[model samples]
Structure formats: structure tokens, C-alpha cells
Target: MTASPTLFTRIIAREIPSDIVYEDENYIAIRDIAPKAPVHLLVIPKNVSARLDEITDAEEMGRLWLTAVKVARQHAADYRLLINSGEKGGQVVFHTHIHILAGWENGPDSDT
Candidate 1:
């Protein structure tokens, strides 16, 4: 049987609409539908690992972080890189993703 598509997969396919911020051979970044800060972007791998634990190599993880950092710097704002690993980790979407939040006017400072 064919696997079902995740929300991010559909977005990447352009089956659903999204504000794409960046795109490359292996990844795509989009504006988060729910804003947690003045600036928020969701960076996801096109490879579609359902969760961090499912990732087989460091390459994908490395690429995701590199992209996130590039995006954060481009925005010229201090940023938070968040990855909610599993259900207990508060990950709403099954597809693994990085939440890039910046331009924090008010909020507790990130521990990192």
C-alpha cells in the first residue's frame, strides 16, 4: 500500500498553499502558520523523516541546522531553533521540522 502524505509533504508538493521562504534540492523553509514570535519559519527536509529518531544520518540533521542558521542570520534577529522530537516533546506534526523564531520583543530568554 502507498503511504499517506504528511502536511509538509503536501505543502512541498504545492498541493496545499504555503508561504515558502527558501527551497533547495534537499530542503524547504516556510513561514509558520501559527506565529510564535515576530518572525517564525519552519525548516523541513524534503526527505520526509517522520521524526528526529527516524533520521538515519547526520547529513540531514546538519543540513537542516545550516539552513536554519542561514535563515536566522538573514533575518538579522536573534533566533531560537526548536525541534520537538516526539509526542511527549510537543510535536504536533509528524514530519520532523525546525522552528525558527526571532525578533523577540518580549519573552523569557532562550537558555541557549
Candidate 2:
């Protein structure tokens, strides 16, 4: 059976273009094609792991998490990070990725 297209795979293959801000051997930081916040970027790993829970290797998971932190700092000094796991968790793309959102306030009166 054909597999679903992963977010990382689409970025790597250039099937879907992104506003790439940073890139390295291990990861790539790009602006979200559909941004929810004023400043939204997607930090994706080079490795093709489908979801966060699917990653069994501790070292690999650690590396990806670290990469997310690094990318987040670069984009926003104070950013909100999110990683949706499954459908229940709002994981639209099967591929594991960290969403860095900032440049917006989320106070009590702030609109979500």
C-alpha cells in the first residue's frame, strides 16, 4: 500500500516549498506555509520518522528535540513550542516536527 506523504519528506523533496530560514545536516527551519501566529516556523528533522511516538531510539529523539530548541531560539527570543503527537493531539502531518510560534501575545484578553 502507498504510504502517506510526510511533512519532512515533502520539504526534502521540494514538492512543497517553504520559507526556509535555517538549515543544517540534521534539521531545517522554515516558515509555516499556513501560519497560525504572527511568527510561525516549522522545525523539521532530516530523518523520516513518522511521528514522535514512533521514535523508539532515545538518542534520535533527543537529537531531534535539541534541534527544535535551537531553531526556536533563532526565530523568537520567547516562543511557544508545540509538538502534536497523533490525530487526537492535532497532528496533521504524520511526520514528527516542532512548531515554533511567537510575535503574538496570549494574555487573558488576547484572542486565540
Judging by lDDT against the true structure, name the best candidate: 1
**Tens digit of per-residue lDDT, candidate 2, span 33-66:** 7888888888888776777888899998888878
Each model's RMSD to truth, in Å? 2.9, 2.3
Taking all chains together, each candidate's TM-score versus the true structure is 0.89, 0.84
Clashes of each: 0, 0
Q: After superposing candidate 1, which stretches have Cα over 4 Å from the reference? A: 106-112
Tell me the TM-score of model 1: 0.89
**Model 2, runs deviating above 4 Å:** 1-4, 105-109
